[model samples]
Target: MERIRRLLQRKTLYEPLEGGSESPDGEPIPHSKQQPFSWLDYSVFLLLGVAMLWAWNMFLAAGPYFQRRFESDDRLLRNFQSAELSVSTVGNLGSMILLTKLQARASYPKRIVASLVLNIVVFTLLAVSTRLFLGVTASVYFAFLMLVVFSASLATGLCQNGVFAFVSGFGREEYTQGIMTGQGVAGVLPCIAQIVSVLSVPEKKSEQGAPLESSTSAFAYFLTASVVSTVTLAAFAFLLSRHSPRQRIKRSLDSEDSENDPERFVRKSVPLVRLLKKLFWLAGAVFLTFAVTMMFPVFTQQIQSVRDPHSAPRLFQPASFIPFAFLLWNIGDLIGRVSPAIPGLTLTSKPRLLFILSISRVIFIPMYLLCNLRGKGATISSDVFYLLVVQLLFGLSNGYIGSNCMMGFVEWVDEDEREAAGGFMSLCLVAGLTVGSFLSFFAAGSS
Candidate 1:
């Protein structure tokens, strides 16, 4: 038992957490007194980069195909399927939260490494298999595809949760923003890939009445994704090996820690009731954001449907909004992430204020819808401009809202239940996203 405890208690990373005696202003430090991974930690950052690479390629390969394939489907089906996929992925987030909470208690690096490796393998398999088998139209193939998506979602959720947990243990609050930024960067690659596909014309049909077919360009996308994943896994393996050089926390220090310390324990365990309340509020915010953003997909689909009635539909590149608009949002978020240092930025600390501001777009969404419906009065450019402004505002609000979400829950809950609180909040956010997509499908049909 002593030997096992000693093995688990080793500290592998973080310079900032160890050097600072006082808490860094604004950054929440975990009770374990562990700091989050620092930028200096090459392995964590490298892993983040590799993950981002894989993420971008996977999106490139899969998103265009899915968008094109489903363009003509009933709005409700499109919405429902998208929501279902979102829900499955979000639900996996709950599992991730649980795992992180366990990691906090155990502090086992081996377990974390094993989980991460498994996630990579599972995700790679899903991406490769789904892309390759896409030509098969049988029910069996369809079921298999769905299964693969489910597995992919699980893998992604697991990876996200594990990273969050692992980073938190070291007291790294920046991990969240860093991860989000990585996601934003990864998005850029897919956008470029989609544009390239759009620019490439199909070969001219011969006079022999042969059907002109689109090349499987997306396969190159997925194949690139698989290679990125392979490289990421290799990097992770190397980083884990380097991890051993860092000093391990002595076993005596870990075993002595427990819930008996009232101040510490209370700080750690947030009440479940409080956590749920936070979820309801955050869910409402997410619902509002998703409701408006879901319009992007719907609008793209609508435009394509109108333009290509008889023509076999190809993927539309509205993913331009993802990299562009989402980049704007993330930049705002990055500002918020660093805002704790600025005196003025700290003024907007009220939970309700942030939440309301975040969801303010619910009012604007109706107007965008109204304009979109009044088609003859407004030019397409005018309508699109209006829509873009609304989205930008939405992104800005989200910048504040997403950060508030983490802060608000922390304020609401006592410290101990932080994991459960965060998990529940994530679950609600995901649910709202799923519901929003589902609603948008029907709403598009009506429009």
Candidate 2:
């Protein structure tokens, strides 16, 4: 045990001169000791990232299913859109508030656990609410549903901030990448599950009462999502229990000297104003990245392929295009997130280039709008393949550029500042989501 403890303790290799910290070559070296992370460290970071956002992803992916539940009543359908927007807005608000106000004061692991617990409770309630309130009045049902949506969003915000802070402690670029990759997977898995659930239901002989069928499907989908949330909560708990370099370093440093506190070594409370000024551009990039990307589910689903009157009905119907587009976007996002692992793909060194690419993503909005969906004007093309390709590229750019921006921001600050940086960036991300979700309402109106 003593040998292990000694090995885990970080050792200072060089002492700085009294007058200056610069070396002979005039390069200023960091005074903090560094601990190298192993493969296990990498794996844990990646899994935590995945688990952190899985519930949020599942919630977003279930949009179609939830929307379908009110197909019978046009009034309820219109209200559903408002409710959807509220959920996103409230959720983002919750996350932004938590990260901005409480991140520095709260313990990261405890916050993460709290968020996961909230998710389990909220999801379970969603599942139970669907079953119990299926026959209730529309007003009552929507009210209950909105409460669940708000709760889920709050939990998501808390979890995302906690997860980002937790992983940032490792101070490894790959750990950031792992978390981003997990986020992409979170989007993908839920989409796949939705597709499977949709396919499993038998085709009805008559098209009458489609709304009833949709409601039933919605129940099953929410139930599945709740179960997944439960599993994710369990996995997160297990991962949190394991030892990592960050924990080991803190433990050793705490044992060695109370005056040289490890927690204090890596975290300093900087003025929010100064922090915002330093991170403005990076935060804007993250905001724009998510804003443009959020438009996808909001607008893309409204686009339908120009129907072929002469063709027979297919097994994977054109209606599946919405989910398929979602799937492609997520897969492309995963590919993009993984791309930085390749030495040649890393562009964090070039902030200008990355920022330009991120801003250019606005082009996708117009491209998607002009596609032959439910828009007001002439469409450039009604080709389903064209839309799919566009979605793939959109997802690719979103993941790649978003990851680069996030990782670059982390690297820009001192090791002690990384956790706060993560929180700030998370706040930006939520801001973007909220703004984008609001914009989605306008996009919906235009259609």
TM-score for every candidate vs. truth? 0.65, 0.82
lDDT of each: 0.45, 0.66
- Alpha carbon deviation, residue 169, candidate 1 (Å): 3.3
Candidate 1 has its poorest 10 consecutive residues by lDDT at 19-28
What would the per-residue lDDT of candidate 2 be over residues 227-283, giving only the tens digit for each residue?
655666666555544533334455455556535644443335655676677777777
RMSD of each: 9.5, 7.8
Error of 1 at 324 (Å): 8.0
Task: Compute the lDDT of residue 344 as modeled in candidate 1.
Answer: 52
Candidate 2 lDDT (Cα, whole model)? 0.66
Model 2 TM: 0.82
lDDT of 1 by residue, 191-225 (tens): 55555554466533323322222325555655566
lDDT of 1: 0.45
